[model samples]
Target: MIDTSSFQGKKAAYYTLGCKLNFSETSTFGKMLQDIGVVAAREGEKADLCIINTCSVTDVADHKCRQAIRRMVRNNPGAFVVVTGCYAQLNPQTISCFDGVDLVLGSNEKANLLQFLSEKWSGMSSDAGRNHLHEHFSVKTKDIKTFVPSCSRGNRTRYFLKVQDGCDYFCTYCTIPYARGFSRNPTIASLVEQVEEAVADGGKEIVITGVNIGDFGKTTGESFFGLVKALDSIEGVKRYRISSLEPDLISDELIEYCGRSRSFMPHFHIPLQSGSDSVLKLMHRHYDTALFAEKVRHIKSVMPDAFIGVDVMVGCRGETPEFFEETYNFIDSLDVTQLHVFPYSERPNTSALSIPYIVDDDTKKERCHRLLELSDRKTMAFYNRFIGKEADVLLEKASYGKAMHGFTANYVRVELPVSESLPEYDNSIRKLLLGDFNHDKTALKATVI
Candidate 1:
């Protein structure tokens, strides 16, 4: 066993990049340190330890991870730096080569971070050189199988519950499976217990996050729909939003349940990496354009005002000009609210590297810009549809001396101006009328009913 007293009175700083799952995991790491008497470092205060959770979805994400590591080390000056997450799992040696990186933990090892810290906390050195990281620090991606549960509110009004982890799908041009390992998840009963705990801690909103949340039954025999049904039965959770799910895994029964359920919001986020059937075939995607469009049509058939977000990738290995045009036309016809468009980046050890006809950088930039513009138009149209409608908004705490902001059940951003007549809106649900766009046009202005 590790000694807990070694961590007492130590101040630590945390830096997290990437998805909501990474943020949820970092928050759990903070709670683990706090239990051992380590406090968070205040502004302008030097810290004794630094924890960085990184992402490796794209080459740009990897670059940002390295930048964050160096900046944290420079700011903390003699702190024990620990790096983990997808980047650390895939490229531990590259990260260890950087100056002042004390340890690089793997995906499975992140769950036992406190034990690793206890072993190194005594007589620790912050030297830039020397063999501080051992070969045993990271396990091979195939060896990772543990599922660690995390339910925490990290600087947000909504609590993120990590019910699942890892991915089994190995799409061409993707490195997530190699970085996150095979699909796995906890039992429905255990996840329900975690939700109850969050509710006990006064959590009003919960977002179900995971790498492949739709593949929730790989480790356990429970289904994702079973997990959803169980979570909706919890008493104190006023809202629940699903982060993203595969189009093939979104069953008709699940969509119907969310359409009628009391707590499940009328919001959905699905990924359509390429709208062109030929490009999707090259990427080895399970479903094609026809199925994806039908899914969108079905969602709208049940809930007309639902907010649908999509993920699109431009400039894959074999995406030609004709294929790009096909993708644009298909997306322009969808009822999606927003688009998350990103240019494809080459990653090591992926099948896409061998494909012919790679796109040029200039062409990729143009395609990304075009998709983003279409996304803006669709988002504005969706927001305008609800301008005169009444909505029940769950207000969040004010920040930056600005008016309070919140989201409706369908995930529309609403801002309420600060005034004495307004009730204490922090963490309170208020019925309001959606008005015109605010000054910057970021969110819709709202007035209390």
Candidate 2:
């Protein structure tokens, strides 16, 4: 119904703001624009259209979105700015108030951008008239499972394939459920086919990423274990990694699948949020600290060398100093390889904002620093275990200052001396001798065989 004939020679540039899902959506949008004869360019470059996929996870996301729009307008004075994603979905009116913002498309309407743009182009006589389309293009959220795969850019050995979107859990202090809507997952067969295509395109690794990866099978009655099994069965994939998963979703079958499957990496990133049961209850998380610890113990039992990463948020409401100490000590006692510490940032319309006893900023900073220091120690210890042992590394690229750097199977950063084999070794798994303590003990330098 929309005319694309007017956009034949036009160009567009895309910018992504948040998680892997945002990147995937940006890439999909880029492909859609490209299909309609719109050339893709880098951000800050002169282009007819600038598409920005925004995020609303943190309070700073709004500022970043606005700044990006300003920068785009500065570089290309007359460019049309199309804003979509979480920030646009939740705060379209606020985003539309910006000076250079020409279109504010919500998450549901992002797919129809090209169609809308084409329709606008047919109606507008001059560039000045196109701004009116912003008001008309505003869309209400609809129930549709539009699985558009993101195009992989950059020299990434691994590609993040977003097989799912949205979240069902409305945890206090979290705005994801409101921003992304309910959980929706693609069919296992479709995902397997995507993995095959990625493997064929020379992607050495594929990361299964989503808002709530643990809630994958809840909607369709297809378990996360089933998805893992299907992806593990795919041929030509060197490695596959699962992104953030909730503690309750870490089942015995999933652990067993990782242990037995050749392609699945022995690295799991499960979010624990808080270690204190009382704090976790206040946060409205599903699982307790005991259940979470049991899950970690079980993973270690199955794959002892598995790189376990835990997510902890500090300074949530009602988290006392003693509670934080409990969290720090609990993480220190665990066999986790690393810690991803997030200093809790309160967002608008979240339950945590209403809760009393919010920790001071200084106390939150201190707690974050304490956990980061602990993380340094834990990561170094994990790296030291592989010292003097040969690790199969998928060499990525040559660093400008340091030598070639890549990741091992267990997700350790390994750097090797620059050599003739470096180019051929890129994206290929090769054996390397991991050396001891560099300037930072956490990372290990290597020499290729």
lDDT (10s digit) by residue, model 2, range 186-246: 7788788877888888887888888888778756789778898888888898898898889
Model 2 residue 126 CA deviation (Å) reads: 8.6
- lDDT score for candidate 1 against the true structure: 0.89
Look at candidate 2 and tell me the lDDT of residue 262.
90
TM-score of each: 0.97, 0.93
Query: Relative to the true structure, how large is the alpha-carbon lDDT of every model?
Result: 0.89, 0.79
- In model 2, which range of ten residues has the least summed lDDT? 128-137
Model 1: how far residue 113 lies from native, Å: 0.6
| Candidate 1 structure quality by residue, lDDT tens digits, 221-319 | 889999899999989999999999999999999999999998999899999999999999999999999999999999999999899999999999999
Root-mean-square deviation of candidate 1: 1.7
Instruction: Give the candidate number with the greatest TM-score.
Output: 1
